[model samples]
Target chain A: AQTVTQSQPEMSVQEAETVTLSCTYDTSESDYYLFWYKQPPSRQMILVIRQEAYKQQNATENRFSVNFQKAAKSFSLKISDSQLGDAAMYFCAYTNQAGTALIFGKGTTLSVSS
Target chain B: DVKVTQSSRYLVKRTGEKVFLECVQDMDHENMFWYRQDPGLGLRLIYFSYDVKMKEKGDIPEGYSVSREKKERFSLILESASTNQTSMYLCASRYAGTGTYEQYFGPGTRLTVT
Candidate 1:
C-alpha cells in the first residue's frame, strides 16, 4: 500500500511572496507519478503540477513548481509570486504504473494575504 | 479539454436513505473514480471503474457501491446513507493505460446527511 503525507495543515503567504508546501510518501513501487492539486471555494479539484519519479529535473508550470526527490520520496510544491487566488487547499497525490486512483495526502490549506 | 461533471453540486439526505451520486465524463475516458473528501482526511477512494461494466473497490468501500454501465459514466451509490458519510464527494476520470496519469476531476458534490 502507498500513502502520502502533508505535515502542514495550514500556511499563509504574503502576496507576491513565495511559499513551499511539503509532501512525503511511502511506496514500494519504483515507477510512480506525483501530483499537486488545488481546491478552491468552488470545490473544484485543479491540477497544479506533476513530477515523474524517473525525472531528475523538477517540473514547473508558470508559478507552480515541484521539488521532487525520488530517493527521499519527497515531493514539494513551490508557489512563486503568490497571489490571492492561490488561496486554497493543496493536496499531494501519488499514482503507480497501474493507473489506479490517486493516493492523496491530508492536504495543506494555503492563504495568500495581500 | 476533458470535462467531468457531477450531477449535483450539493445534496441533503437523511440517515438510512438511499443515495445515488452520478458522474459523467465527456472525453470517453476508460477509467472513472469516486472519492470522499473530508476534513483532515484528504481524498479517500471509494470505488473505481476501468471499463464499462467493470468496477473495483478502492481504499474505502465499506458502505458504498458503484455502477459503470457505460464508458463515460460512473455512479456511486449508498445503499443506506449515514451521517458519517456526509462529506464532499469527488469524481475523476483518466485515460486508459497512460504514463501521463493525469485525472480530470468534477466540481464535487457536497452531501449532507442528517
Candidate 2:
C-alpha cells in the first residue's frame, strides 16, 4: 500500500521569506506523481504543484516548487517569498501510474507571520 | 477553468440520520472522488467513480457509500451519521486522460454530526 507522511504538524513562515514542508512516501511503483495542495481557511483545496517521478527536474509553479527525490522517496514543498495568503494547511499527495486516486499525507498547517 | 461545486458548505446532522453530500463538476470530468478530511489526518478517500454508474472503494469506505448516476455528479451518502464522521468532506474531479495528473477540488462541506 502507498502511504504519504508529512513530518511537521505545524510550520511557521514569515511574509516575504521562504518555508519548506517535508513530506515522504512509501511506494514500490516506479512511475508515479507527487502533488502539493493548499487548503485555506475558506476550505478550498488548491493544487500548488506536482512532480513526475521520471522527471529529474523538479516542478515549479510561481512561488511554489518541489524537491522530488525519487531515490529517497522524499517529495518536499518549498514556498519562496511566502505571503500572508500562504498560511494554510498544505497536504502532500501521491498517485500511482494508473492515476486513479490520490493518497494524501497527514497535513502540515503553515502559518505565515508578518 | 474547472469548477467543482458541492451541495453545501456547512451541514449539521443528528446522529443516526442519513446524510447525502452532492458534488457536481462543470468540466465533464470522468473521475470523481469523495474524501474525508480531519485535523492531522489530511484527507482519506472514501469512494471514487471513474464513469457514470461505475464506483470503486478507496482506502476508507466503511460507513460510506457513493452514487454516480451522471458523468459530472458524484454523491456521497452516509448511511447513519456518527460523531466520528463529523469532518470536512471534499469533492474532487479529474480528467481520466494520460498525463493529466491533477485533480480539481471543490470548496469542502463541513459536516458536523452531533
Candidate 3:
C-alpha cells in the first residue's frame, strides 16, 4: 500500500521569506505522480503543484515549487517569497499510474508571520 | 476553468440519521472522488466513480456508500451517520486518462453529526 507522511505538523515563515514542508511516501510503483495542495481558512482546497515520477526536473508553479527526489521517496514543497496569503494547511498526495484517487499525508499547517 | 460544487457548505445531522452529500462538476470529468478531511488526517478517500453507474471503493470505504447516476454528479451517502463521521467532506474530479493527473476540488462540506 502507498502511504504519504508529512513529518511537520506546523511550520512558520516570515513574510517575504521562504519555507519548505517535508513529505515522504512509500510506494513500490515506479511510475506515479506527486502533488501538493493548499487549503486556506475558507476551506477551498486547490492544487499547488505536481510532479511526475519520470521527470527528474522538479515542478514549479509561481511561488510554489517542489523538490522531488524519487530515489529517496521524498517530495517537499518550497514556498519562496511567501506572503500572508500563503498561510494554509498544505497536503502532500500521491497517485499511481491508475490515477483514480490520491493518497494524502497528515498535512502541515503553514503560518506566515508579518 | 474546471468547477466542482458541493450541495452544501455546512450540514448538521443527528446520529443514526441518513446523510447524503451531493457533488457536481462542470468539467465533464470521467473520474470523481469523495474524501474526508480531519485535523490530524489530511484526507482519506472514501469512494470514487469512473463513470456513470461505475463506482469503486477507496482506502476507507467502510460505513459509506456512493452513487453516480450521471457523469457529472457523484453522491456520497452515509447509511447511518455517527459522531465519528463528522468532518469536512471534499469532492474532486479529474480527467481519467494520461497527460492529466491534477484533480480539481470543491469548496467542501463540513458535516457535523451530533
Cα deviation at A34, candidate 1, in Å, is 0.3
* Candidate 3 chain A worst ten-residue window by lDDT: A42-51
Superposed on all Cα atoms, the candidates' RMSDs to the truth, in angstroms, are 0.8, 1.0, 0.9
Ranking by TM-score: 1, 3, 2
Which scores better on DockQ, 1 or 2?
A: 1
Taken over the whole model, the C-alpha lDDT of each candidate is 0.94, 0.93, 0.95
Q: Candidate 2 — which pairs collide?
A: none
Candidate 3 - CAPRI tier? high
Task: Give candidate 2's error at residue A51 in angstroms.
Answer: 0.6
**Candidate 2 chain B — worst ten consecutive residues by lDDT sum?**
B36-45
lDDT of 1 by residue, A46-68 (tens): 99998988889999999999889
TM-score of B-chain for each predicted structure, in order: 0.98, 0.98, 0.98
Off-target runs (Cα >4 Å) in candidate 3 are: none
lDDT, ranked from best to worst: 3, 1, 2
* lDDT: worst 10-residue window of model 1 chain B: B95-104
lDDT by residue for model 3 over A57-109, one digit each (tens)?
99999999999999999999999999999999999999999887999999999
